[model samples]
Target: MSETFDVIVVGSGAAGMTAALRARDLGLQVLVVEKAHKYGGTSATSGGVAWIPNHGLGGSTDTREETLTYLDAVIKEPVNRERLEAYVDTGREMLGWLGGEGINMISMPWPDYFAELPGSRTDRSLVMPPWDGRQLGDKFPLVREQYPRFKLFNRYSMNLEETFTIAARAPGWKKKVATVIGRYWKDRSTRKMTKRDRLYVSGAALIGPLLARLDHKGVKIRLETKLETLITTGDKITGVTVSHLGRIYDIEARHAVVLCAGGFEWNQELRDRFYPVRTSIWWTSTPQGANTGDALIAAEKIGAATEHTAEGWWAPTMILPNRSASNFEEVHQAVFDVGRPYSVCVNRNGDRFVNEACSYDRFGAAMASDQLATGANTPCWLVFDAVFRQKFTAGGILPSAIMSDRSIPMDWWDHYIFKADSVAELARKIDLDPAKLEDVTRRMTEYAAKGEDPEFGRGSTIYDKTFGDPTCQPNPALGAICKAPFYAVQIHLGDLGTKGGLKADHKARVVDGSGNPIPGLYAAGNATGSPFGLNYPGAGGTIGPAMVFGYIAANDIASRATNRDVASAREPVAT
Candidate 1:
């Protein structure tokens, strides 16, 4: 006989774990099944910023329509306004709910994706409070492994302690490298320092706080438990088959099944089968354990309709050696933060691409054009002077630190960051038109001297400056390439995960291929086709929606089961 609960959640990514937490809160017995060895999933490996629209949280100016405009610019299809609105509606409400349950939110008012438009406002972006390592107890190892080895800080008060400690000692560029990581490592609320500590806040902060909340409630989190199949009868889902460590088991959810298994970005065959382009490499910044499209597939096998498969959570990336996504946090910071001499970014042809320092989307857009107009997939090249390369850290390009945390593993760059003495020689090593390389250098130098980008126009947008260092002299994008012993590395187009999958109604119930709801089944996070269409409004936006819908699915399931919505409740899919 199979065990059962009120709800069965597959995959413990942010959405899955969050759904389980919310379900338990609604008084539903919940079982969270994860295929990975740990909790966190892709969320563990991501920057923790949740791009949000206007929350009643003080200063956020983000609105529903501006968000839609942001989405339309990058996507290739129709935006499902009805379903998408539900996501927005829940975002503000649930965010407050989670905060009430001990999740900490810091208002930045700044646009996460760095939009400078009229509607763009700061402080609306919610940042999870930094969690104390002492609170995590046994989960500290899980937290450490989840984030790249970073320095610890006051988990709750992001500013009070961290900012004062830094400003008191490491003023100016003397600030620690970790402090330069954007919101990934710092606390944002206390307003302790005059200058914003660029410390980052990613899975460490986002997942950390949520995990802490779930811990407080004693949620049973099982790892290495892969959900195998959905038991259905007469169109209703009754239970799920699960396998762990060679053992098979069944767990029936009396109320519902919430599929939060992340998208199938790591599945090579799936990537090739569904993606528009055919390429050998796919280096999305997703967590290493992100191979669970099972939620989407299982639902589909049972006849769920879908949308948004044409695109994904994508960005431009540097193709480093040993073939991995470039350390973007490092890449962006190096070009803009380290105060290194200006550099120029170019493609394999040695010609310039998008604003080298702009957000990954613009970079991806230019590469997409190159792929469609010219058959180019491997967009490589990073031209830096000796000063820039010496001081700057370009994400995965630089080796990770070993002991004292000052340096990276030697193997990191040995695999990528092709090195040569001169522009012509470097072009030879990367294999591109030599004349084109030199000509690009000549033009870039001229542009840097004049301080303007004639091509893609890098520093033109306010969004461009959001990630750029205010210290650069010439336009951040127009820095001259005059420094000697210049180096260029190859970059690639990467997707965090496919945004396409099973289409679901606002309640997160899977809709059939015929556009009918599949009872007793629901999905959130990437497992369901994105409600955002191709539009990604901000950084944590994907995660924020996932968490919100996860909460909704849980309560809705419990509501129906308890007869709270007696009149509207339909019979379970499988009797």
Candidate 2:
């Protein structure tokens, strides 16, 4: 830990650490500086699925052109084609490298969130390797011990749809009866349940192995080492100035400097300036320290150019009123994905605004109307009924794990999530323009009756199709959201982090305004613009790009260093 070596990485998240580890493998010394007093960075708290194409680990020879074709459909804009190709090519190479690093990769061959799109390969779009967490030693706190910076995590993922599905299948009368008994019993611990009752989510799966990989690397990670400034030499970067342990240290970069600090999701000032939604009441699945846009500011001091700083990774994310304190868990799969026999989500006008089954990314974009966020994107409601909430989940999720009140009770439910005895009363409570809601629901009922979608075109994306319930006849992802005594729950525009940042090339070299590489500087993960460009097709898509670029940057730095050593030895001392 005392010696400085070949590489000095700025953040210890997946990208930064991966870069450092790869550099070490290339026979280069590496040092990782972390600002949060932990080694995992944002990746420690991630879903951990790496979206890779044509993994070499499996000996797949999938063509690069096929990969590009798939990427083209997802990303509407012309991407840095070379950088994207590097992502796919190096992603495959990196997968094999992980094997040598003692990581066992696991692949799940399921439909992709964009399977409905072109070149959507249902075969292994994402993977997670079994890693040894014991290797982290005393630094495991930096890995598994830290929960949300603000909240406790004895709850489940509310954003996930399956929790609602389980809750809805419990039988309406059973849920009601259980609720009454739950009040009298006070502690349900008296009832015996299986460990399966405690769910394991995607985030936990990813964070575990990520820590293991760091432990195996023998890398010294200093948390709380905030990157304050970049040590620049004229137009090039030389070293870095970090404030760590209450003292500022001038550290030199022997190889390459990579910035993996996350995007500015929690910074209210930055969010207000760059993002579409303007609010101090932002809700995120990210940590509070995510406020630090150190990478953006630090790189800017030395004139680093970036891409699309206006919009973030926007998603039509849902949130509870004061329930922001906790994401209550319940089961509501039927409402959001199934289109079940009852219920539909409506906005303030009590009208259906988006395909209820759209991915959070696409759905969030469509929710940005002319009035909200100064004609940007604001929050909307997910409406349903007593029969539905008591039977299924509204918005198909329980923002957290436990609802203070399990049944339909408050008008907090109105704007938050409207529930009424009649369609008319629900309309009055939320101040909807009656004609529109009535007509919308009437048509919704007809569609549910036929088990088809027409309005917003639900079940169009592979993501929507994955949420489908095949047991209901046609597509489980499609149906008419029609059940009487409807309701609506409010959702906000939320994000894990923004994807737009310093543009990088195939080598993961930071690019300038004129599209030239910034020497001795590299960026990966959310600190750089997405390799997926503007399109985020599935879950883990972001994580895969982060890992791939991390490896590429490391390889580039190591190869150049080797060549530089050869050049320096041949030259005589000028002095």
- The lDDT of each candidate is 0.63, 0.61
| Per-residue lDDT of candidate 2, residues 426-463 (tens digit) | 77777777676677777766765565677876655556
For all the candidates, what are their Cα RMSDs to the real structure?
7.2, 7.3
Query: Which candidate wins on lDDT?
Result: 1
Q: Which model scores highest in TM-score? A: 1
- lDDT comparing candidate 2 with the true structure: 0.61
Model 2 residue 310 CA deviation in Å:
3.3
Give the lowest summed-lDDT range of ten residues in model 2: 190-199
Query: With candidate 1 superimposed using the best TM-score fit, by how many Å does residue 422's alpha carbon deviate from the native?
Result: 2.6
- What TM-score, over all chains together, does every model reach? 0.82, 0.81
- Count clashing residue pairs in model 1: 45
